[model samples]
Target: MQEISYKQKVLKEAKRQGIISCWFFLANFAASFLIAVYKAFTQPHTLKQLQNLELIDSVITNLTTLAATIYIWLAIKKLADIYDTDVYEIFIKAVIAVVLAIFLLLALGLEGITPGAVKAVSYVLVGIGIYFFILWFKLNFALAKITNNKLFKTYVFFAIISAVVGGAIKTLAMFGFFEGGVYMLAAALSIAILYVLPTAFYLYAWTMIKEE
Candidate 1:
């Protein structure tokens, strides 16, 4: 039996991880699009029912993201071990930030929480979200340099555009700038294009990595 070099090991893991990531993203994106379209087309009699559906969708998306984050961290850790790079540290921090954000969001649902406290939590969550994006961009940039894969760079570009557009839509929705149906439809389109593009690029980028 012959021992493969670390590059081969990393590529094998990446291919496996890429398939998993691709499936997760596809599931998440499809679910989100379907729910948004349903909400846009049909009106539920009760607000609670609508809210419940949205909550379920959000939970599924967040769970998928968490799982993907862990897988990405593990893959990068292996690469870092082989290359003696520090990008895995960013993954560790990103994972921690995401978990903390999720926990804080859940805490916001507790009864008897003051409005001020809620506002503060929201601010913290926003900050954490921004930091996570920065870390994510840095991690991808580092991987792009390490692997010389333009797909990673392409992901970064589309990710930034997605973030900006999604953020704008959310902000406008908060201000009641659009009707419910309009907002949901717009959000669905945003998720379809913005979210799917980056994930697709990421998956393809993993496939592009090969040993020299």
Candidate 2:
């Protein structure tokens, strides 16, 4: 077999990441849109109907998330060679943890869930978020190590800014510091960050891709 150089490897990885990013955005977008339509149409006039609808939504969301995790994992296992990192294992573990956490989060959204369960599960979610932090760190570290590209760093901060500012606004609104419209805006902003901001940065990074 012909020995491939570093530039070839980087290019291959870049192309792979580009494909992965598109699928990530599309799959999540479809899931989000379907969820919106489901919530809009599934308004129940009776207790049993409400329970059934909620169950269906949970299954839909969980399956979509599971698919996303697996699809992203395919891209992830490719990256262990791009930057020579050991995060493939970490990535697998994080995905497992996050899938569980997401289920817990969805349960918390259920109508009659207890406050005690919510409180306890909220802390567990935060702990699970730490796994995400580790995953993010590994990705950025690998990117920085492989190329001189600083776009990942920018993506990182803007992503964080979106979450922090949005969360603060949402929290204040919840505390009665704002009205309905403001609260809605805050919620939208947070969701937008979680879903849209990364894709924006990801596409930009691809435009600026270089061998390094």
Candidate 3:
């Protein structure tokens, strides 16, 4: 009975991850498409004009964080439950991570918000988000190492690439590397990276859990 119950939980988590993965992809695609369209219609969009529509960017961030968090947690749960490892602390971390990620996103969404100024406790939130982001990445990479699965490793490889390209483009854009039509290209690249990360992570996890 206990064994069967364990299997059921694993299966449940696997199915949940699958559903969430699809949603993440759709939400990401919609957000990116909307942003690109918005940029196209307003070629000469200024800081204010761009920032005004930042609300859309904020929504995208929220969706990204939410989907990413749940997807990570589902993976953690599957690994812990199946191997009878203690999942209590990791569950708590997952909650904290998800909340912080979403909160940072809300900061991004508001009309006046900027990376430099999130108003109150801004540094605190950003600090937490950065730490959690690194920690989460490490944990995931550790999982990939343990699984030694080709798919998981591939996901890891591409995730690194996505982060590099995304981060580089953002930095360049800050220095005006992306402007005019070039900015639109950057927008497309950003959306593509966003879509790919969760797709890779979720598919790898889903495959692992399903075969478990």
- Lowest-sum lDDT 10-residue window in model 2: 1-10
Best by lDDT: 1
RMSD of each: 3.5, 5.0, 5.5
Question: What is each predicted model's overall lDDT from 0 to 1?
Answer: 0.78, 0.66, 0.66
- The reply for model 2, stretches above 4 Å from the true place, is 5-14, 25-60, 99-128, 177-183, 206-208
TM-score: the better of candidates 1 and 2: 1
Runs in model 3 lying further than 4 Å from the true structure: 1-9, 12-19, 42-75, 86-88, 98-123, 145-150, 194-198, 208-212
TM-score of each: 0.77, 0.65, 0.61
Rate residue 122 of model 3 by lDDT. Answer: 68
Clashing pairs in 3: none
Which candidate ranks first by TM-score, i.e. highest?
Answer: 1
Residue 30, model 2: lDDT of: 56
